[model samples]
Target: MTIKAGDALPQTTFMIPGDSGPEPRTAEALFKGRTVALFSVPGAFTPTCSARHLPGFIEQAGALKAAGVDLIACTAVNDAFVMGAWSRAAGAEGITMLADGNGDFVRALGLEMDGSKFGLGMRGKRFSMLVEDGVVKILNVEEPGAFEVSSADYLLGQL
Candidate 1:
């Protein structure tokens, strides 16, 4: 089912590009006892994702932290290497990059989208949420081909 307010996030593993290499991080490890501002993009380095979606979070990360968020995280269906590269290329210092390389996390939340029309395969939908202690407090899922409610500004406003 699509994860909603009050729903506990599903158990899944995400890859993070560690100092040595890709490291596995469990959902519980990331969310437990933390107020996380989590956002997902269709893929890393895509037009809108690179230009706006990710940058918006990177730009407003401090404001989010000031608003009581403990962590700012970004996720995508891309692998850890891509996520790491994107983080570096965008200078996303404060954001945690969570790599759902196989779309397992998004699929568990019923948020996967078909991107085959653009030569891309299945991918995660563009969305953002406030997760507190592993439960969802707020969710903003963008409509197909739209980038409205899922922006960092919108989430900050909600906070």
Candidate 2:
């Protein structure tokens, strides 16, 4: 089932770009004791994701932190190298890039989307959630082809 408020996040491994190469980070390791503002895009560097979605989080990182968020993280079904490049290109200094390279995380959350029509394969839907101590406090999932609910500004308002 799709994860929702009050649900604990599924255990999964995400790749983060490390100095040497992609490094594995488990969901438990990342969220066990932290309040995290996490967002997911269909893919890294895609139009809406690149121009707006990811940037919104980057722009609101400080506000989110001030609102009791310990970390701001972005995830996509892309590899760590691509996520790292996108982060650097977008000047996302404070946002953590979590790479769901094989779609394990999203699949486990039941948030995977089919993007074959756009030449993209299985990908995560656009969504954001407030997770504290590995439990979801809020979840905002966007409609297909829509960007209204999952923006950082919207999430900030909810906070």
Candidate 3:
């Protein structure tokens, strides 16, 4: 089922590029007692993802914190290495880059998209959510080929 307001996030393991290598992190731990703004994309380094989605969140990250967001993160179906490279390439310092390499999180949320036609396999749909204490407070899922509702500006407006 698509996640909605008031639902606790599914317990799933996600990864980030750690100093030594990829490190595991869980949703429950990530959202415990904090407000998180997490946005997901189909893949890292894609055109819109690199130029628009990622940059928007990075640019607005401080403003989001000022608005009470404890953490801002971006997720993709790629691996931790790629996520780290993309973050470095984009200069996305404050935003955490999460790797859902196996698509477990997106599959659990029923937001996986088949991108085989583009030579990309299963991927997460573009979406963003306000998660507080592991429960969703708001969600903005983008329509196919759309970037409207899930953008940082839109989420800021909601906040």
Candidate 4:
């Protein structure tokens, strides 16, 4: 089942790459005390994700923060190296790129999507959530091939 509003985020560790090296950060640690706007993409550098999903969040990071969000993040079912490279290429300075390597975090939240037919293996569906202090406040999950709700503009209106 998809996670719903009011559910506490799953406790899962993400393999995130920092300037130093790969580091582990738990879901609780990332959202426990912050009002966060987090969006997940199927894969980094994919057409829709690169052209729209991530760039929207990066462009609106300042507005999101101005609306009281503490942090804005982009999560992908990819390794830290790929995520790091994508972040740099996308000019995502205000957004933190999180690597859900091994899909542990995505599976824990019941958001994993099978994409083997597309040669992508398992990946995350396009979605965004507003989380405050460890509890989900709003969740916008996009239907396959659709892009109406999960965009940053929609989330900004929700806030």
> Residue-wise lDDT of candidate 4 within 1-159, one digit each (tens)?
779999999988887778987788888889999999999999999999999988899888889999999999889999998998998899997888889989987888899999999999999989999999989999999988788799999999999
Please tell me which predicted candidate would have the highest lDDT against the true structure: 1
TM-score of each predicted structure versus truth: 0.99, 0.98, 0.98, 0.97
Backbone clash count, each prediction separately: 0, 0, 0, 0
**lDDT per residue, candidate 1, 50-73, as tens digits?**
999999998999899999999999
Which portions of model 4 miss their true places by more than 4 Å?
none
- Residues 1-159 of candidate 2 have per-residue lDDT tens digits of 898899999998999988999999999999999999999999998999999999899889889999999999999999999999999999998999999999999999999999999999999999999999999999999999999999999999999
* Runs in model 1 lying further than 4 Å from the true structure: none
For model 4, where is the 10-residue window of minimal lDDT?
14-23
Better of 1 and 3 by TM-score: 1
Stretches of candidate 2 exceeding 4 Å from the true structure: none
What RMSD value applies to candidate 1? 0.5
For all candidates in order, the CA lDDT equals 0.96, 0.95, 0.93, 0.90
* Candidates ranked, most accurate by lDDT first: 1, 2, 3, 4
Report how far residue 97 has shifted in candidate 4, in Å.
Answer: 1.1
Candidate 2, run of 10 with poorest lDDT: 54-63
